[model samples]
Target: VGRDKLLRTLQYFSRFYAWYLFRTNRPQTAIAPFESIKKQFGLTRKILRIGKFIEHFKAAAVAFDNKAPVDPILRCLAVGRQLGYAGYMSYDTITVIHALGIKKLANPKKMQENAYRAWLASLVCSAIAGVYSLWKLHQREKLVDRTEGEGAVELKKIQKYVFSMQERAAARVQLISDLFDLPIPLSGVGIVPLDDGIVGLSGTVSSLLGIWSAWKKTA
Candidate 1:
């Protein structure tokens, strides 16, 4: 995961830098290198992501069996988020096969379009889940009583409160990352008029966030 995030960071930064060089009227010789780097990293990431759909599919299956007394709406959103990501990854796997020339596709462009559409749906589900998680966290926080006198019960409440705050912080970061990522797919599906510069920079920001989160998990 860390390696993938690193590649993604480099890929998007290369794209943004190439756009910058062109926009600044740099010589083609100067801009070509970064463009090449961008393409290489993008292809490498696609290869690395092969067969990743199974992971998301497994997660969706696990979510489907969740019997916890959480809100039904949140549970449904969780399942939807996983399924959306599974669809994205499955479509992406096909694109990678086409990219590698393992099999010629009749309409490579349409395959790419479908992959982007799946990715857009996944991001939408993720963004919505993040928002809903934060709202639920806020409601949970309100129910914690901070004014209780010192006792075992008070200590437990304090601990729970701290944990809830940490969860809220994580949720906020994810929400911001999802928002940054939304423009890429929006532009991919022609829902937005963003140029490469805008999309690349947005992707760079979200990639950095992914790196940070992955680093934390590893540490």
Candidate 2:
């Protein structure tokens, strides 16, 4: 009789224990099955957030808008924090970081446009120098009494093509400047022939100067 009572008592507790464990697992059960999904979404949102942080990089890659870049940067930071500290800096999180770094050059509001303008202008000047040098070479060839025949004409034609390329290349620099709101004029740019027959180039020095000003202010 005592043994039977003891058995009933133990059985009763076991039933109660099982019920407790089951009832308490309501929230826990849902978690194990959905963890992967939660992480995937969390990470995707994080990546997109980072994209906004580096809007300038996007502008550089794509000539989208040049308005305020700060808005996007803030968005990225907010999303990143929501993703939690641990997940915010994961492997793919690096995508946002790299994009941000690469796009840093596109911030025209910080006078970045001037900087690009300067670089493009310098390129234009260098190209002009190259073409003038080649033309001078061609002219010297024609003046030479040695083999001033078919070779000279062919050289002149090749040099003309080269000049065309330089002209086109220089024109692109202006386009780059225009994108940044600093207009550049192709006029007043000239190349002088040096004593050693080498070519020297000079143009508006202000493009680079303006670029320097932008940098100093940015700093």
Candidate 3:
């Protein structure tokens, strides 16, 4: 009778343990479905945010307006070119005076003064050009990035305009090349053959003349 009682008790304990395990596992099994739903919800939100961002960029691009007449990059390049020419002229003037042994022709201090002017001018021009070039380069990069995000149509328009400008610039460069090729005397003195110094001086004169003419036109 005791053995039978013990067997019955062991069977009862086993059944109770199985029921407890099942009860404990039910919540964990249900959590998997909730986790899947959460993952799907987060993915959908991210996609929506990205779509909104792209639409905002497109709207802004459609309303883009740059009404200013003057292009800063072109003006900066022009100024840098003029300054480079002027710097070259200053340096060359010293070289010419020294080479011709004209120190004795003028006051001894004149040579020193000219040398100082040349180095100072060259240094200033170089520093300004370096800084402006770097700044303008970065600005162009930003402009390109902004344009690219606009859309295909805007990018095409930009490309077309850039090509047209390039053609115009090429023609201007060719004209300059032809003009420089012509034989021209450097100075009224008739002794200094047309050299790089003279070319630099001519560039300075031409740039100044263009600026003066533009000013007059505006006035």
Candidate 4:
């Protein structure tokens, strides 16, 4: 994940830089360097993502088991999110093969469009899940009752409060990342009118968030 995030950050930055050059009427010679970097990193990321659908597929299966005592709606959202990601990865894997000339797809554009749609669905599910989780946390916060506890009870309450805060913070970060990512897929699928510059910058922001999250986990 860390490697992919780093590559993604560079890829999107290249994309944005290339667009910036073009928008400012810079010579094609000026834009070509970043354009090449963007294409190369994009292909490399696609290669790295190959076969990743299996992971998300397993996650979907686990979510379907419903072993956790999570809220019903959140559970459903989790399953949908995993399934959507699995679908996106599956389609994207094929596109990668076509991209590398290992296989010639008859309709590469259509395949990419489908992949983007699946990704958009996944992000939407994630965003909704984040909002619902935040709402649930808020309800729990109201019931925490920090005033009526003593000694061990007070410590327990304090621990729970801290955990809830952590969960809330994580949810907010994920929601922001999803929001930034939404524009990329939306533009890819022609659902929204966004130029390459906007899409590229949005992708860069989302990639940086992914990097930060991965770094925190490692640290």
Candidates in order, TM-scores: namely: 0.94, 0.21, 0.28, 0.96
Clashing pairs in 1: none
> Which candidate number maximizes TM-score?
4
RMSD values for the candidates in order, in angstroms, are 1.5, 29.7, 37.5, 1.2
lDDT of 2 by residue, 53-115 (tens): 244344333322335453453344333322322232232344434444644333323242232
- Candidate 4 residue-wise lDDT at 7: 89
Comparing 1 and 4 by TM-score, which wins? 4
- C-alpha local distance difference test of each model: 0.87, 0.37, 0.42, 0.93
Candidate 1 TM-score, C-alpha based? 0.94
Query: Per-residue lDDT for 11-90 in model 3, tens only?
Result: 33333333444446756565445444434432332233332334433433432333456455544443443443344344
TM-score head-to-head 1 vs 2, winner: 1
Residue 162 of candidate 3: its Cα lDDT?
78
Residue 110 of model 3 has an lDDT of: 53
lDDT of 1: 0.87
Candidate 4 lDDT by residue in tens digits, 1-219: 888889899999999999999989999999999999999999998899999999999999999897768788998899999999999999999999999999999999999999999999999999999999999999888789745478888888989899999899999999999999999989999999998899899999999999988777778
Candidate that beats the other on TM-score, 2 or 3, i.e. the better one: 3
List the candidate numbers ranked by lDDT, top first. Answer: 4, 1, 3, 2
